[model samples]
Target chain A: MIISEMAFFLLVTGALILTVLAPVVLIGLFIKDYFSKSIW
Target chain B: MTEFALDTQTALFIIVGFALAWIAFGVWLGRKNKSHEDFALAGRNVGYAFAAATAMATWVTSNTTLVAPQLTYQLGVWGMVGYSFAALGLLLFAPMAKRIKQILPQGYTSGDFIRLRYGRFAWAVFLVISVVYAFGWLVSLGMAGGILLEALSGLDYYIGMTIILAMCVGYTLFGGLRAVIATDFIQALIIILGVAVVAYWLIDNVGLTSIHTELSHAHPQLLDLLFPAAVMFLFNNIFFGLGEIFHSNVWWSRALSFRKNVAYKAYLTGGLLWLPIPIVTGFIALAAPQLGIFPASADMIGPAVASSVLGKTGAILVFIVVFSALASSLDSLLAASSDLVTQDIYHKLIKKNASDQQLMRFNRYCILSLGVMTWLLCLPRVATLGALLNFAGAFVASTIWPIVIGLYWRRLQGIFAGIAMAAGTIVGLVAYFWIGFYVAALVSCAVSGLICAIGVVFNKSQFSWHQLQENEQ
Candidate 1:
C-alpha cells in the first residue's frame, strides 16, 4: 500500500506546475478586468 | 528561547513595514466606500478577477499554511491529499453561489437567508453556530499569527498576535469588504509565488527523490496509502470543509458581493486554482526528517524546515506568505462576522430603523470589538492550530445539511431544521470529546443529514423563493 516514488514525484511536480501557473492566470485576469474597468 | 532564524529586530522591522503599508492601502481603498452597501458588500459590483482572487485567497488561511503541514507531519501523505480535497467545498458551492445571488439579491448575510427561510427558532440556532465558528476561526488565525512569528524569529507571541489582529481590524474597520477584496488579489499572487519558490527550492536543492528515499527507509508509514487513521480522516476533512464553506457568511458575502453572473465561474476558478496548493505546501514537510529537523510542535514544521533549508530569505518569504494568508482570511472573517452582528442582530433585532450611516458606524465598532475579543482569547494559546480548527469543524459541519437543504428544498420545516442543527452540533461535540477530531465532522454531518431527511419527508409547505428577496430597511 506504499506510494511509489514515481507517483510521489508526479504528485509534487504536477502540483508545482499548477501552482506556478496560478499567478499567470490571476494576473491575466486582472489585466483583462483592468482594461474593461470591471475589477471592482 | 530556541535559536531564531531571522533576528527579532529584523522580524519586528518586517511586521512594522508591512503593517503600515497595508493599513495605508486600506485607507486608499476606503475612499470609494461612501454607503453602507459599499463598505459591507463592496458595492455589490465585484468583477471576475477580484471575485476569483478573493475566493481563492481567503480560503488559503492559517489552516492551509500551518495546519496542512501539521497534518502531513502527523497523518502522512493522505493528510495533504485529504487537505486538498477541501477545494471540493468551493467547487460544490459554485452553482449554489449563483442561486444565492439570484434569490437573495438584497441579502446581507447567510443569517438573513436562514431567518427568512426557516423562521426565528432556526435562525437563532444558526446564529449561535455562526458566532461560535467565527470566534473559533478568528482565534485560530490570531494564534497562528503569534505562532508563525515565534517560530520564525524570537518574537513574543503576545506582541505578534496583537499586531496582526490590530492590522486586520484597522484596515477592515475603515476599508470594509472593498479593501478586503482588493488586498486579497495581491495577497493571492504573493502566496502562490512564495509557496512555489519554497517548493522549487526544495526540489532543486534537496531533491524530492532523496526525500522520498529517506522517508521510505526511515518513515515508511508516510508513504502508506492504506494508513488507517488517514483513511478515516479523508471523509471527515471533506465534510469539515463542506460545512465551513456552505454555512459560513464569509463565502456567502462574497457571493453577494460579486457582480451579475460572476459567482459561479469565480468560485469554480478559485477552487481549481486552490486545489494544488496544499500539496505544494504540505509536501515541504515530508522533507523534515530527511533534513534532520524536528520542530517542537508539529505545526511549526513548515516554517522550521523551510528556514533550515533556505535560510533567512526563506524565513522572510514564509513570514510574508503566512502573514498574507492570515490577513486575507482574518479581514474577511472580521468583516463577515461584523456584518452578521450588524445586519442580522443589530439592525434586524435591536434597531430596525437605523440609517445607512448608523449601520456603517456600528459595523466599524463591531469589527473593533471582535478584534479585541479574539486577541484576549488568543492570549492563552488554548490549543495547537490544528486542534482548535478541528474543534470548530464539529460546530460548522452541523450546519451543512440545514443550509443545503434549506436552499434547494422547500419541505424542511423551521422547527426540524433547528432541531437538526442543534442535535448535530451536540452529537458532533460529543464525538470530538469522546472519540477524536477526525470523526467529529463525519458524525455531525450524518446526524444533521438524517434529521434534514426526516424534515423533508414530513414537512408539507412549499416556501416561496420571493421570501428570500428582503429589501433594506
Candidate 2:
C-alpha cells in the first residue's frame, strides 16, 4: 500500500516537471523558427 | 453551491478581451494568403516548430483538460494512465504521416487519400465516418467550453457556448490554417503553463502524500493497481485514441501542410510532449476529496477542484487553460472539416473546374456553416463529454485497419475495405448499445481488422502508390 502511494507521488512529480519543460522547449524552438523564417 | 470564483462581469470581460485579440491576430495572419493552397494547407511549407506545436496543441483538446480528470475520478489511477496512452496515437502516426506526405504531397485532406487510394464507394463510406467523428468532436468541444465557463464562473451555458464557437469560427475563417497554427503556438504555451502552475500549487499546498493517503482510506479503488474495470479501460481507451488520430482529417491536413522532412519528427515530439499532460491534469481530481469539493458531474471536477482550492486566481487560471485548449482544437476541426467539404464535396463532386480563388471563398463559407451547425447542437447541452466522444469510437475505430492496410498493403480492394468499415461500424454500435462504452473501440477495431485480413488474403488486385499522385492538380 505504501509502495503504491509512493509510486503515485513519483509519477505526479515527473509529470509536473515535464509539463513545465514542454512550453519552454516549444517557445525556444518557436524563437529559432521565427528568426529563420521557418514559421510559415 | 453555485458560487463563482470570479464575478460574472470580470469573467465576461476576460472572455471578450481574449476573443477579440485572437480574432485580430487571425486577421493579421490572413494577410499572407494569396492562393487556395495557402488558405487550406499553409502553402504546404510549415516549419518544424509550428508543425510540432500545432500537432501537440490541437491534440490537447478539452478531452485532455476535462475528460482526463473525469475518467480519473471514476476509473481511478488506471484511468489517468489509460488516458495518457492517447499519445501513442500521435507517436505511431509519425511514420504514417511521413508516408502520407510522400504519397500525396498535394493532398488537401484525408478524404482525398481515401478517394484516390480506394474508389468512390469506399470514399463515400469514409466520408460518413469522417463527418460523424468531426461533428462529434466539434460539438463536444463547444459543449466543453460552455461547461467549463459555467463550472468556474456561473456563466450561462448558452452564452458561453455561443461565444466560443463564434470566436473560433471568426479566427479560422479569417486566417485559415495559418491563423489556426499561429494561435495554436501561443495557445499551447498558455495551456501548458496554466496546467503546470495549478498542479504545482496543488502539490505545494495540499501535498501528494495527503492526497494519496486520503484516497487509500476513502477511495481505495482509485489507487488499486489491480482494479479490473480500469484494466479493461486501458486498452479500450488506447484503441479509441488510435482510431481518432488515424482517420481524422485534422491530423492528415497537418501532415499534408508541414514541410517535407518535418512531419515525422514533429509528430514524434508532439506525442512525447503530450504524453504527461493527462497525468498532470488528472492528478488534480485525486485531490478533490481532500479539498472537500464534490462536483455535480465528473467532467466539472477539474475546474471545481482548482477553483475551490486556489480561489479566484486558480479559477482565472483554469478558465484560460481550458479556454485555450478548447479553441486550439475547435479551430483545427473547423479548418480541417471545412477542407474536407470544400475539397472533397465541392471541388471534386460539384464543380471540378472551380478556380483557386473560388475554392478558397467556398472553404470560408463551409467554416461559417459548420460553426453555426455546431452551435445549434451545443445549445441543448446533450451528453457528457466522455459519453459523446466514446460514441464516436464505434465509428472511427472501424477505419483503423482499413486505413493502415490501405496505406501499406496493395491486396485490399476498395469493395472489401468499404464493406469492412460499414459492417464494423454497425457491429460496434450494436456492442456499444448492448455491452458498454469501454468495449466500443476494441470491438470495432477487431471486427474491422478481421475483415481487412480476409480482403488481403483473397483480393488479387495490386494498388500502385503512383495512383495517389496522379489525380492531384
- CA lDDT of B110 in candidate 1? 98
Q: What TM-score does each prediction get for chain A alone? A: 0.96, 0.80
- Regions of model 2 farther than 4 Å from truth: A1-3
Candidate 1: the clashing residue pairs are none
Candidate 1, B354: how far from true, in Å? 0.2
List the lowest-lDDT window of 10 residues for candidate 2 chain B: B1-10
* Full-model lDDT, candidate 1: 0.93
Question: Against the true structure, what is model 2's DockQ?
Answer: 0.69
Kindly give the stretch of ten consecutive residues in candidate 1 chain B with the minimal lDDT sum: B464-473
Q: After superposition, how far is residue B245 of candidate 2 from its true place, in Å?
A: 0.8
RMSD after CA superposition, every candidate:
1.0, 1.1
